[model samples]
Target: MYRFTGSWLHKALVRLCASLLAILGLKLSAFYFLGLLIVLGLHREQLLG
Candidate 1:
């Protein structure tokens, strides 16, 4: 029983870590895309001006 509990705990921790990493990766990608969009917009305005 103790061994089973330990295995469960290990699996839970791994799942938690994986979820956190996926969320962080998505957030970083979103921020990067947003920054690129802003820079592109600014350049477009400058070109028009």
Candidate 2:
């Protein structure tokens, strides 16, 4: 019983860490895409001008 409880806690921690990492990845990608859009927008004006 004790071993089971300990293993469950370990699994829970692993899952929490995985979820946090996923959220961080999403945020990083969003920021990267936004920066890319801004850069593209700037280049568009230069190209059109």
Candidate 3:
């Protein structure tokens, strides 16, 4: 019974960590893309005006 519970807890912990990492990765990528877009816009304005 203890072993079964331990295994279950381990699985849950792994799943939690994986989900957290996935969320972090998504947020980082989104921020990076947004920054790139803003930089491009600024560069275009500088070139045009």
Candidate 4:
């Protein structure tokens, strides 16, 4: 019936959304960590020079 299909579709949509957000979060965290490393490197160079 329509109700069953609707519930299934809703569940699928929620799962898709959760997966996309998780991927996005991982990329963001990686970018942040990379930027932090660059900043630390610059700071170290400044201190040494």
Could you tell me which 10 consecutive residues in candidate 1 have the lowest summed lDDT?
40-49
Clashing residue pairs in candidate 1, if any?
none
Residue lDDT tens for model 2, 1-49:
9999999999999999999999999999999999999999999999999
lDDT value, residue 22 of candidate 4: 100
Report each candidate's C-alpha RMSD, comma-separated, in the order given.
0.5, 0.6, 0.5, 0.8
- Flag clash pairs in model 2: none
Pairs that collide, model 4? none
Question: Which 10 successive residues of model 3 have the least lDDT summed?
Answer: 1-10
Report every candidate's CA lDDT.
1.00, 1.00, 1.00, 1.00
Candidate rank order under TM-score:
3, 1, 2, 4
Assess every candidate by TM-score: 0.95, 0.93, 0.96, 0.90
lDDT of 3 by residue, 1-49 (tens): 9999999999999999999999999999999999999999999999999
What number of backbone clashes does candidate 3 have, counting pairs of residues 3 or more apart or in separate chains? 0
lDDT of 1 by residue, 1-49 (tens): 9999999999999999999999999999999999999999999999999
What's the residue-level lDDT of 11 in candidate 4?
A: 100
Candidate 2's clash total is: 0
